[model samples]
Structure formats: C-alpha cells, structure tokens
Target: MPNAIRRYVRFIDRTNEIVGLIMMYMIFLMIGILLYSSIMKTVAIPPLWTLEMAQFVMVTYYMVGGGWALKNDAHVRMDLIYANWQPRTKALIDTVTVLFLIFYLCLLLYGGFSSTSYALKYGETSYSAWSPYMAPVKIIMCFGIALTLLQAVAQLFKDIAIARGEEIS
Candidate 1:
C-alpha cells in the first residue's frame, strides 16, 4: 500500500477501535440505566433521555465502525454461495459487491448530509425532558458515513489489485 493510504488506514483502524469500545460501553451503560429505571419507578419516572442518547450512539457507532468491519471481512453475510466460489472468482464477486456498496454509500452520504443540515437548520430535538443538542448527533452520523465511504474506496482499489493478480499491500 502507498504510504498515504497506509497512514489513513491506521487512523481508520484507531477510530474503529475507539468507537467499538464506546459502543460496548454504551451497551453496558444502557443496561445499567434500564435496571436503575426499573428499580426507581416509585422514586421517579426514570428518564427518556437515555433512550434517545442510545439511539444516537448506536447510529454513530455503526457508521463509524462499518469500514473496520469491511476491512476485517467481519460483517454478517449469507456466505454459502461465496464459500463455493473459486478464489479468483471470489475476488471478482467481491469486486462487484464493492461496486454495489460504493453506490449505496453514495446515497447514504447524500441522505445523511441532507438530514444533518435539516436537523441543524430546524434545531431538531429529541422528545425527551433534557433535549440535548441533537444536531451534533446528526452531524456525527454524517461524518461516520463519510468515513465508511472513504474506506470503501480504498477497499475497491485493494480488491481491484487482488483481482489483477497483484497483492493488495
């Protein structure tokens, strides 16, 4: 790999690691929050803020972690057909899949940006008592999508190289 690509991939890898930890933490936090809410029913009505916050974190983490999943080939898939293909044929199929993802991510980026802009312009807020700044969450999602799209382009190149009988790195 070129130095620049390698550098960026390292950065992406770090981002993925940090975000994965954050996601795991969020899951634990949610569980704790739910238990607390259940226990405190008589004390108070708990809070809806946790729900909205969890939703935002989930979206952000998914987008940011998507590229890392692709790099590790860790995404869940129905791999029965893929497992049967020859190596070279698998590379071809993988290339085709990458192309499809590229197109799909384009749509995602566009939609994400539009939604972010709308949320920012309208000062959108979650239907919770503590209506935090939701625009930051919207923008983070868009940023995450952009990160995945960048990695997709890199993966497309890597796949092309592999298909052409060249090592990816």
Candidate 2:
C-alpha cells in the first residue's frame, strides 16, 4: 500500500479507537450516575437529571461505538453463507455491499445534517424536566455517522485491494 493511503487508514483507525475510549468512559459515568441516583432515591431525593443525562450519554455511546464496531468488522452479518464463501468471493461481495452502504450513508448524512441544523436553529431541547439542548447530541451523532462512513470507504479500498491479489498484512 502507498504511504499516504496507509496513513489515512491509520488516522481513521485511531479516530475510532479514541471514540471507543470516550464511549467506554461515558458508559462508566452513566453507571455511576444511575447508582448514585438509586442510592439517593432511598432518601426521597428525586434526581431528574440522572435520567436525562443517562439518556444523552447512552445515545452518544451507541452512536460513537457504532463507528468503532464498523472499524473492527463487528457489525452483524449472515454468517451462514458468508462464512463459507472463498476469500475472493467474500471480498467481491463485501465491495459490492459497501457501494450500497456508501449510498445509504450519504442519505443518512444529509438527513442528519438537516435535522441537526433545525435543532440548532430552533434551540431544540428535550421535553423532559431537565430540558437540555439537543443540538450537542445531534452534532455528536452526525459526527459519528460521518466517521463510520469514512471507515466504510477504507474497508472498500481494502476489499478492492484484496480482490486484486494485493496482500494485506
């Protein structure tokens, strides 16, 4: 592989790694919040922010972790047939599927951007008691989807190279 492409792929990988770490910390924080809230409930102190913040953190976790999962090839697939295919055949199938995925992701990215824009313009906030601004979570979601699309492109390049008899080490 050329140095530039290799570096780009490495950058994507690193981005996913960092995102995954952030997600992990977010999950830990969510757990702590829930535990504290549970303990506080025994004393008749209602922690409304705990539920709202937990929901936000959960959304961020799923969105960011999705990209990391894609980077790791951990997305769901039909293993019954795909596992039996030869490597070249698998590569071809993956390349073709990736093309469709790119199209889908393009649409998703456009829609996400539009929705995020609307949220920012309207100062959208949750309907809960906390009613925090929604723009930040929407922005994070769009960013995660964009990163996942980038990882898909990288995977397409690898699949094409593999189809062309290039050794990937």
Candidate 3:
C-alpha cells in the first residue's frame, strides 16, 4: 500500500477500535441503566429517558460497531461453494464479492450524504423530548459506509495478492 493509503488504513483501524469500544460501553451502559430504571420504577421514580436512551444506544451500537465487524471478518456470510474451491479460486470469488460490496456501500455513502445534508439544511431535530439534532447521527451512517468501503478495498487487494500466489502473511 502507498503511504497515504497506509495512513488511511491506520485511521480506519483506529476508528474501528474506537467504535468497538463505544459500542461495548453503550451496551454496558444500557444494561445498567435499564436495571437502574427497573429498580427506580419499582420505587415510583419512573426513569423517563430509559426508553429513548435504549433506542439511541441500540442504533449507535449497531452502526458504530459494523465497521469493526467488517474489519475482523465477523460478518455472517455463506461460503459453501467457495469452501470447496482451491485457494486461488476462492481468492477470485472473494475479490469479486468485495468489489460488489464496494459498489453497494458506495451507494449507501452517497445516499447517506444526501440525507444528512438535507437534515442539516432543514435544521432537523428529533421530535421527542431530547430534541437531539438528527443530522449528526445521520452523518454517522456515511462514516460507517466509508469505513466499510475502505475495508472492501483492503480486502480486494489482499485477495488479489492471494490469487497471485503471494503469501499474505
């Protein structure tokens, strides 16, 4: 990889790591909050933000965590045919699949950018009590899409190297 791309990949790695950490933290926080809310409600405290926070945390956890999932090759995939193929043949299939996903993610990034732009332009905010600006969160979808795209490119290069009988390790 070129220096710039290597740097970008490093950035992606850092971003993926941070996102994973945040997701884990969010999960723990949500679980703790729910427990607290349950206890408080039993005492008539009635935690109001629990429902909204849980919903937002779920979104944050999933969207932010996806790049890390892709980075670690943790996404669920069916490889019945590829499993029987030779390494070189499997590399080819993997390369093609990564390319396809690149196209798909590119579309997502484009649409996300447009939607976020519209939201920001309109000063859109959540209708709920918190009234958090929705644009920032909408933009995160684009960041995730971009990270996935980067990962796809890295995978494409890796697969090509493997198909050429190069030892990737």
Best by the lDDT measure: 2
- Candidate 3: give its CA RMSD in angstroms: 2.7
In candidate 2, position 153 carries an lDDT of 82
Q: What is candidate 2's lDDT per residue for 1-169, written digit by digit as tens? A: 7777767777887888788877878889889888888998998886788888888889888887876888788888888999999888899999999999989888999999999999999999989888889999999889878988888887787788788877443
Candidate order by lDDT, highest to lowest? 2, 3, 1
Off by over 4 Å in 2: 1-3
Between candidates 1 and 3, name the one with more favorable lDDT.
Answer: 3
Enumerate residue pairs that collide in model 1. none
Question: Which stretches of model 3 miss by more than 4 angstroms?
Answer: 1-18, 45-48
Global lDDT of model 1: 0.73
lDDT of 3 by residue, 52-159 (tens): 777766777777787788777789988777678999998888989888899998888889999999999999988887677788778776776776777677677667
Local accuracy of candidate 1 as per-residue lDDT tens digits, 1-169:
5677656656765666566556556566656655676766768876766566667766665766676677677888898888988767778888899899989999988988888788888998876788887789878877777777777777776676677776554
Q: Count the backbone clashes (under 3 Å) in each candidate.
A: 0, 0, 0
Which is the winner by lDDT between candidate 2 and candidate 3?
2
Q: Which stretches of candidate 1 lie over 4 Å from their true place?
A: 1-18, 127-132
TM, every model: 0.80, 0.92, 0.80
The TM-score leader among the candidates is 2
